[model samples]
Target: MLLQSPTQTVMSLEAPNPLSLHIIHLLMLIKPATSGGRFRVLRTAVSFFYMDPTLMSLRSLQLPSVNTGFGGSADTRTKDLPALQSALLQLTQAGILTDEDSNGNGLNIMPVTCVRAAMLIRCNTLLRGHSGVCLELVQALLLLLRKGMTPIVPLRGSISASGDLIPLSYLAGMLEGNPDIRVRTSTSFVLSADKALELAGSEPITLGPKEDLGLVNGTAPSATLGCLAVHEANKILLLAQGLVAMSCEALLGKAENYHPFISSVCPRPGQVECSATILHFLEGSSLVQSLKEEDKFKPVELNSASDNPIIDIKSGEVYSGANFISSSVANGMEKSRLALQMVGKLLFSLSSELINPTLNRGLPPNVVADDPSLSFTTKLIDISMAAYLSELGYLANPVTPHVQSAEMHNQSINSLALISGRYTLQAADVVAQMCVAHLFAVCQALDLRVIHMTYLKALRTKLVSKVLPFLNGFDDQVAEGIYERLHETIVKSWNASACFDLQERCKIPSKETIPVLRDHLEEHEMHFVSTRPLQRDLENLAYPTFTQTRSEFFVKPPTKQFLGRASLGLYCFVREELGVHFHQGLVEHPGRKTSGKVNGRKKRTIGSWVSIIFTALTNDQVWGHLVEALGSRTCQVRLV
Candidate 1:
């Protein structure tokens, strides 16, 4: 009956909704707290309406949580009606839930669709606590979503068996009907396979287990990583080429060293190609054109390589071996490191060029010669920072062998190619950051000088605006100190600064920046020349085991005989200025006289050759005059 009392009477407005009525009955029995705690009663009323159905269904069927409480494994039994009701009431009263209508039923809800969706959300949230394959899967799913492709059901067995399983599964779930899967989706719910075909007037894909597995599994993480590594390595190679060109220009190196005629003479592909690239990179500009031939390449010690693993899907076997090893990439990385080091040193010289009052090219020290208090020290600091960062990158280059054994008995542990892939990615990022810093320093130095071309000025302005925006003026130390942090952030900027500047400065419209940089590298003798054809040799070379038990297993490559037939495989061209030097000896004049003659004379020649005809038959200079004489004469000498 409708009552007229001091309190409100709650009743069901609809007949089919028993849960709503149950909620109304509870609200009527529990009055709003008199102590201004009205929010609590309202919460209980809402909670009861949502949980009532699940509770009532269980009560009618009789669930275990009612008699023994909510304590049971998956085997014990389903939840009880009373306990479920109590938990829901407590949650609602605390304002931890909301009322949502679905299928004409009042249910307690959060922001997601189903239980799996909630778990996916939790999985991503838990990423802050852990990493590796799970994180990689999430990232891949994110990528797939960006491209508007949906993944199907994920299998537990497939991830352990294949490299891309987990990631694909995560991606598929996110793309499916469950909105809570929370992958970046363009629209809510995937219309279901049936509806999609009808709407589009096309047959629906009835995907099987094998097809689904094929879609998600079989990804070459290591290979792709290697591919990405190669891509990044290419960039570093370009930057290294640029550094070489700058050095060539600074040292006044000759262009003939990079001539196609010279590269054609030697058939080794990498050498010829590298030489060609360097030459192309430095095609124009007054600096490179002015250099003489014999002024390139400085001697140093370095070595590097990249490795990957392979799998045979048909045989259900993972033959962990190298499909491709990046010896060329590693070598390039090391060489670039050394080349950039020298470039950094040359950059330091620019500070001296501007600082010395007598040698100044009309520019002041610190490039701020107008300000007496600010000295070249500020500019020198930038150079030092570049050098330090270059060293950091140099340290990253190493001969890393691919390890493929097994991860757990399930084989899931060892297939983790993301380890190497992520590392290479990070290293490449570091290299890019270092190059940008160096570029910033160069721009600063150039800004103080007379900019010859409009393109150069324009490029310089653009580069400054994006790469070094914080350097608003000359009086900002905070901006300078943050350069390292900026580099660590892995920012990338592709502009016409390099291209336009080189073209306008060199007056060569047909040439590109990469080619010019390569040409300049050859001019400076920083380019490595090989005697054998690179691709041919690579074809004959045996793929190394991606996973080896012992390091010595690689002592003799399986395809050595096959590779040997390729002819003059890898050879280095050493320039004269970069020749080896020795610094250990004593010299005396022939002034000592004995018995009216210079009997105790010690005349040591710096350039004379003394050949010891035993064992190695090595040569040494005994006297100063002979060595000095040898130094004066120019000869093409080869030693084995």
Candidate 2:
């Protein structure tokens, strides 16, 4: 039977549901001091039920008193009962909230991250087995996750010190079925709060005494963003290593800088690990040269940890500390940006070398025919590489020190870790593009060298012997045999154009011919050049050609998607069209191959060679520029 107040009015109703019956049972348990008090409790309970039918399970719940008075004594509540009730009433009423208002906007965080951060807070609280939150609240969180409902939370309003109150209140509002609040579906569509709840088959949950407090107090936002940033940054580092190695091979650079002995002397863990990884990639490569005294290498530095106020689970204590700040992650990203900038700079230098006549050994100026009006020049390639490098220079500025605090006086200091992470991602993307440009230029240079080898026979012999000494003992007949086999493979596999076909060329007639030979003779001539000769020569001579129609020339540019696909060093021009043999055994050194092992190790492949060369190039550029920037180097080595 339910207890009734003297002033209570009865109403006719249909049969009650399981949830409504549970609410009536809870009403019977409460014994208020006066009719007014009983009426207030009844109204509040009914309001909670309407807001969230899931609160029915919380009918037997009891909350820890806020007035437990510091040391958890039971008697102290006598003096603080009224104050506690007042505070709880204020907190519950605050749930009528929304981030979108006439004066300000909502949080800019993605719906997924916002929901994930909230989930992290809940998990942390439950795992500690404290925070005074009820089992029903746990069930409600699990239901939210299972149903894939992402509550809209504010990014700017979180003070973080007062437990991220304003932002988290919006989340709490969603759970209590605040009609004014909105939710985002897993597909990223926004829906009305009630409509979303119905579709998810989830009812809203009422917040018990300290449940609101438990939901907001932690470093979830900072930690989540920081963790994501760290993960992406690590991947960029791996990719950067490959880019560095390719750049090194393109520039004909030495590998001794990454030798273990050099890193072992200094013994910085990050540098040592970086050196080992780079050296492993360079193994068995013919392109990488021995280190000279003039060559310099930079030391590497990397960090993989998060910073402070960690919750100690064993003691169930929240230790107030600096762990919530993410300066370390931001600093690491800043360094990565600098490293990416160095790669961009090196690419610019390599581009210059490929185009300038005097610097590219014996290659033609602009890497085209002597008559520039008839051939494709590398001018556009150089300009595009410069543009990428300039963008990287702008992105390399550190974001760690650019933040200012604004939340009352409580949050007096701030870390721009999130911003730093965003900048790092952008810089990494640009670095990948720059690497593609460098690879294209290198492949073009190699093609030109092979095509004009009749005039460059002495230089070609020297280069081939220096880069691939294992072919030194082969007779002309034997070498020709190898060339024939390689030519067959290239003809079958080649995909890109082998040479530019002359679309009809215009010719001007003399004035005398136009007037006198109008009917008897032709006034002008047009010529068309076929690429068959170059294509035939590429197969017969075991050489590669950079062939395309005038209309097709310079059509492809380095893009993020293109770079992502090309990072493994396999592309139309470099791999299929050129063939591995045209690289003069730089990719697969014949001497390094054994029946089972070479030097007691497995033989490396063409892809491994490309990765190592790019990684070494990237490392040299980053560390070299860093040393120069710090005024530690008296003279920088010029790539030209």
Native-vs-model 2 lDDT?
0.43
Which residue runs of candidate 1 sit more than 4 Å off their true CA positions? 1-161, 175-180, 185-207, 250-268, 289-407, 412-415, 447-640
Tell me the tens digit of each residue's lDDT in model 1 across 1-640. 0101111112222224423221222122112100111111111221100112343344453322222222122133434433432332222122111222221122432211112221222222212211111222333333332333332221212211234344333333332223322222224334343343233333323222122222233232233333344444444544444544433433335556677777687866655655665565455434434235411111110010011112121232222332223233334444443444444444445434433433433233433312324223235444545555566455454423333433233332233343444345455555544443333333233323322222233333332334343233424564444333332221111112112221131222112322333343365455344313322222122111111211221232221121110000100000011111111112121233423212232343212111111111111111222222223332111100
Please write out the lDDT profile of model 2 over residues 382-471, one tens digit for every residue: 777788788889999987666666444344665665556566656766766666555655655544443333322332332233223323
Compute each candidate's TM-score over C-alphas: 0.34, 0.49
lDDT of 1 at 622: 14
Residue 419 C-alpha lDDT in model 1:
40
